[model samples]
Target: MRREIIDYLKFLMGAPFIKGYRLIGETHLHIQYYSEFEEFKSDHPMSEYTKEEFDQYFNENDTLKKLLVGESVRLLRQFSYLECVTIEIKSYDRVVVEVHSSRFILNKYFGFNIEDLSLGDNTWKSMFVDVYLADPAKRNELYEKIVCKFNQ
Candidate 1:
C-alpha cells in the first residue's frame, strides 16, 4: 500500500501544479490540478454580470453551460491538466499529508479500530508508515518530504 501510494504521488508529480483536493467521506480524496482556466483574468463581457446573475444565467442556459464546460475541459486537456486522481483506501485509521517549505510527508495508518466494535477482543495489530519530506539530521527528526519530490 505504501508503494502504491508512492506511485500515486509520483504520478501526481507530472502535473504542473496541484490545485487542491477535496475529501469525500473518510476514505476518498480527489486531487485537482491547477489549470490555466484559474489564471484567466480579463475585464470582458462576462465580467459585466453580477455573480448571482451569472450563476442564474448559466443555470438557466443548458446549451451555454454545456459549451462552457466543454471548453473548460478542452483547455484543461490541452495543457495536460485534465486528469484528476481519486485516492481510495479502506480500513485506514488515519492519513496525514503535511506540506512544509521544501517537501511534504505522506503518512498512512492502519489496523487500529478508531471506533471499537462490540466484540470483547478489540485489540488489533497496527501499522504506521511515514513518507518524510525533509531529511532528518537527528535520529528522531521527521519533516515534510513529498512536495520537494513533486517539485523535482
Candidate 2:
C-alpha cells in the first residue's frame, strides 16, 4: 500500500496543475489534480477540532473554504515553471512533496497533525542545506570529513 501511494504521487511529476484540496475533519485530505483526485488519511488518532467546533467552523467559515481551494489556484499561478515532484515519506501516511523547476522549489507536507507548505528557491545551497541535511551545520562537517578521508 505504501508503494502504491508513492507510485500514485509520481503522477504529479507532469500533472497539468493542482485543482484543489478537501479537508475532512483533520484526518483525511483529498487532493484534486487536473485529471484525478487522491486521498490521504492520518494514521494517528487525534482530532484537531471538537465535533461542535468543526460543525460551526465548517458551516460558517468562508476563509477555510477559500484557504483549501484558493491556495491551489494561487500556487499554480505563482509557480508556473514547476515541472516535477519528489516525494519523501517521513513515515507511513506522512509525506513531504518537493515540487521544483529550474528556478524554484515548493515543499508541501501532509500527514498526521500537520498540513504545511513552503516555497523557496532551487539553489544548490538550498538543496544541500534544506533538503539534504536536517541540521545545517552537518553539511560543512560532512564535507570536511569526506575531504580528509579522501586525502588519506
Candidate 3:
C-alpha cells in the first residue's frame, strides 16, 4: 500500500492546482483542472475586489468558480517545480510532499485501511490538496493513474 501510495502520487509531477472536498467524516483530495482543462486559462483580477465585492465577484466569475473554497487567490507561476515526494515507512506510517518553489510541506499520517489509499481525515485531505495545487501545470495523469490503480 505504501508503494501504491508513492506510485499514486507520482502523477503530481506537473499539477496546476489541487482541490479538496469534505462531507461529515468523508473527504476527497484530488488535483484541480484534472488536465482536461489545460487549454483554457482565465485570469482573475485580485486587486479589483473589495471584501464584499470579492465574494460577489467570486460568485460571478468563472475563474474563481473553478477554485476550491477558500482558495480564491492564486499561486505565482514561479512555484511550479516539484522538489520531492517522500514516504516514510516506520513505527508509524506517514508521507511528506515537499515543493521546491514554496514553503508548503504536506505531511500525512496513516489512517485506516492503507489498502484503500483514501486516507481521508480532517487534515490530510486538505494538505494533499494544498500540495497538489502548488504546481501550475495541469495534466490529468494523476487522476488517471490513481483510477487505474484502483481498477487493478
Instruction: Name the best candidate (by TM-score).
Output: 2
Clashing pairs in 3: 16-137, 17-133, 18-133
**Which 10-residue window in model 3 sums to the lowest lDDT?**
87-96
Which regions in candidate 2 have their CA more than 4 angstroms from the true location?
Answer: 1-43, 52-57, 82-152
Q: Write the per-residue lDDT of candidate 1 for residues 46-140, one digit (tens) a residue.
A: 43334444333223333222222222222222223223223211112222122221101111121222233122442211111111111123111
Per-model clash counts, in order, read 7, 0, 3
Off by over 4 Å in 3: 1-11, 17-24, 37-40, 43-152
Question: What TM-score does prediction 2 earn?
Answer: 0.22
Residue pairs in steric clash, candidate 1? 104-145, 104-146, 104-147, 132-145, 133-144, 133-145, 134-144
Say what the RMSD of model 2 is: 19.3
RMSD of 1: 18.2
Clash number for candidate 1:
7
lDDT of 2 at 147: 23
Q: How accurate is candidate 1 locally (lDDT)?
A: 0.27
Cα lDDT over the full model 2:
0.29
Clashing pairs in 2: none
Q: How would you encode candidate 3's per-residue C-alpha lDDT over 24-111 as one tens digit per residue?
A: 2211222222211221122223334244533332233332322322121112111222222211111111111211111132112212
Quote each prediction's TM-score.
0.20, 0.22, 0.18
Tell me the TM-score of model 1: 0.20
Q: Residue 24 lDDT in model 3?
A: 20
